[model samples]
Target: MSSVLFHSLRVKAIQPDTAEAVVVSFEVPQELREVFGFTQGQYLTLRKEIEGQDLRRSYSICAGVDDGELRVGVRKVKGGVFSNWINEHLQPGDTVNVMAPQGRFFVPIEAESKRHHVGIAGGSGITPILSIMKTVLAREPASRFTLIYGNRSLRSTMFKEEIEDLKDRYMTRLVLHHVFSDEHTDAPINMGLMDRGKIEAFLGTVVPAAGIDHAYICGPFQMNDEAEAALLAAGVPEEGVHVERFGIAQPAAGAGQVGAVVHEAKPGDAEQARITIIRDGLKREIQFYKDQPSILDCASAAGLEVPFSCTSGVCGTCRAKVMEGDVRMERNFALDRHEVAAGFVLTCQAHPMTERVVLSFDER
Candidate 1:
């Protein structure tokens, strides 16, 4: 896979967005401004050393393309090492390693287009959606946006003030809805979790499905699935709906008995394999074992660095194409069916099923 180098940047400020989340802004030097220039809805991968252990995490860029800022939101996750450290100790003037913006969670925006865009986000998933919303509103004056944001409570919502400001600025062009799981409001439609029923009701009443030009959904796995289903059932085209998943949910007990079954290799299924990896027009060969953690681990063990985040396969950062030879993916929740048919695989979850395998990140 292609290696993405991290640049050490100084933290300019940390603004608290909520009790458990903060918006982190980094100082991008003039020399690196072009390198760090990002599109809306892209994310940055940050690496840091905590107590002698190196940890890397990806956070979505919360600033719009024209916002002239390099910022991301970090929500403190319970028992999360990096998140907790950032919330408690990270401050101005601190130097941290951050990769340039990377992600495909957005669509093209045109100033002359008058389209209706809808964004459905949950909790911290609002980071990327906020970027998209701001960019769309700023770049496309003729376009309108409706946001359906859900959180545990109003106190826990990130970017509350910023979103409210956006609504105020784009009074006639923007529509905002807040759904809280733990809070009660005068209107029942604004209360409770944004499940399938809530989404369906919202589509049926406020935003008609047929009139929506594009829809973006980002949240937990179950919420993503439910929202997508409701949108498609409400007449939204499959290509018009975009979904970005942050993580995978643990399967319920006995749920794997049906659906697609991924086969695990036996001890002697394949003793060894010759792996050839192509990156930036360079090729490296390494010997791999079938029982190894993953093709990504084997390549890393051999001193080959590749772009990767959320190694559990939720993020598509480590995607590569299998040029030649067969491979089996242990688990896949990122790549679409077309990408799989095109020989693309998430190296982090892929294992060699043949003796000789050739893969290239350049193809991706």
Candidate 2:
């Protein structure tokens, strides 16, 4: 089981969450249930082959830890191959390749705790926040949760009824706020995008930063940054603000010098970088053009499959540890400072900084 990075999961059902989003539930066999058992706020990497192209994406788990189901939310986007296929073609009984759960978007839940945790989410970003909200509310009875959800409109908001149900169940312990960018509400605060201004206003009023023990934010890169910044600026400790942001950003230039040894090639041709890939208890050497896309691409060209999804590097599915030599990731959003310091790099964004580098997916 440890050797398998992905398992074929049968779709148990598909429920439409909104016009463009759907909640997908997977049927995990009893034997594999333990393997699929996931912590709240984690995500699953789903893969499907369409039009002869292998498409892979990561979707956050929407179900709580005690939900007794493995589920994720998918929202269709323009030119999204996987999302469109999932929304239109996927049916019950269809099998999808799902990687083991991966994420660190949640904080510890203690039963005796009486803390207030606030969540700021946007559009489909509500998925993991919903999971965390439910888990925390149920696991820590004395704790309170405030969810500030942002969407274009009520019709486009995912998990509307489900969140309402949660509100009813946790009545006094849950605070729900819906902020819409399109629809106008009776209250002024509920209108407009959940940008930095709106979030700063929120931290000053409804869910005061001083009362907040922890803050969880998930949304577009800008919104996430704004919300996190607002929380931090309002006196919330840096560690108390947990954010799950998706997008690409340039990494700061490293101070250390990376060694490079040029291999003989044609004039104006690309240099070749040799990489030793260690996976499934086997070590194999493969060479790739330094000018090529990424190390993951080079590995795939060699017919080697480890684990990967969202080639853009937002998902941590392609994470691998550097065993020897060095590799540089152009940009990274999934790995933290500690993980990067420990030599973990997202293979999709990894470029060989040394002539010969060693990568280990086995260590994960």
Candidate 3:
């Protein structure tokens, strides 16, 4: 399970979306087929060494599972190292290291059913929704899909041309509405952001709120929050709205320094000291460091690989148990409070609060 072996994928192609965004398609090594199989909306964690420093980022799959080609779409953000590299420099036949597809942003589609699916995305959030929309329509012949995308302008729309083509192919079954915030059009509906009023009006006039079988949402933090609230208000069931939040962007290096004050631990106290890990029936001791890097970082540096994605703690890919020690986690956007209290830790965000910490990644 060492991550070192999974870090050798070669880049197949880099397709540009805009001046700042590029879609990097990678060839999955044949030996890692088991790890690359993915659902429609799952994402991949890409790690790379740049300027002698390791950087990690997550990008959502842009194609369906049956397509057999694993890909991710990334948008360059200001001051982002890996993203900027992919946008400006990454080319076909280059190499990039990526984790397997990982995320809880999708639901299984039944084999023989036509369903009504609605997706709301903003900016580059269309990445995962694009895959889901295509899969649902292609798999379920009678199914209908609707995508409401928001962008700053037509020039900035990530997949505007592709979406328009899908509309023509699917005829009336596939609906698309592009909301441009910083531009104007002859049609009133396309002139502004997809705000609460517009969404509510669409639900009232165009699509019935209760008729939606599934809904997918992805965007900036505020956009996601607003869209989820509007959908819930429109009578969509809580379970029907699947949200895919990008990992929270880390602030600039000097934005704020993390401070920690370690509590005292009793000597030889199992609860407060060293924790034991049983992997392949062999026991190993792991000592915790309250102020050090995450447990996953420590383990990986020690040559132990634990599968993970979005190390910013947005994806639940690195979930494991605290078999013996106490840990403190920060910014847990993926797991619920109950799971955290149930001895589960998102190892990517976990830091030792006690001396001994033990975890297992044997898939439950």
Best by lDDT: 1
Instruction: Give the whole-model CA lDDT for all candidates, comma-separated.
Output: 0.89, 0.86, 0.76
Candidate 1 lDDT tens digits, 59-122: 9999999989999998998677889999999999999999888877888988899999999999
* Alpha-carbon TM-score of each model against the true structure: 0.93, 0.89, 0.84
Residue pairs whose backbone atoms clash in candidate 1 = none
Error of 3 at 132 (Å): 0.9
Q: What shift in Å separates residue 60 of candidate 2 from its native position after superposition?
A: 0.9
- By TM-score, is 1 or 3 better? 1
Error of 3 at 237 (Å): 1.3
Candidate 3 local Cα displacement, residue 2, angstroms: 3.7
Candidate 2 residue pairs in backbone clash:
none
- Candidate 2, residue 356: Cα displacement in angstroms equals 3.2
For model 2, residues 185-273, the per-residue Cα lDDT tens digits are 99989999998899988888888899999899998877988888889999999878888865543334773322122222334333677
lDDT (10s digit) by residue, model 3, range 188-305: 7777777777677678877778899898988876677778888899899887888787745445687662222133433332343354554544555655454446777666666665
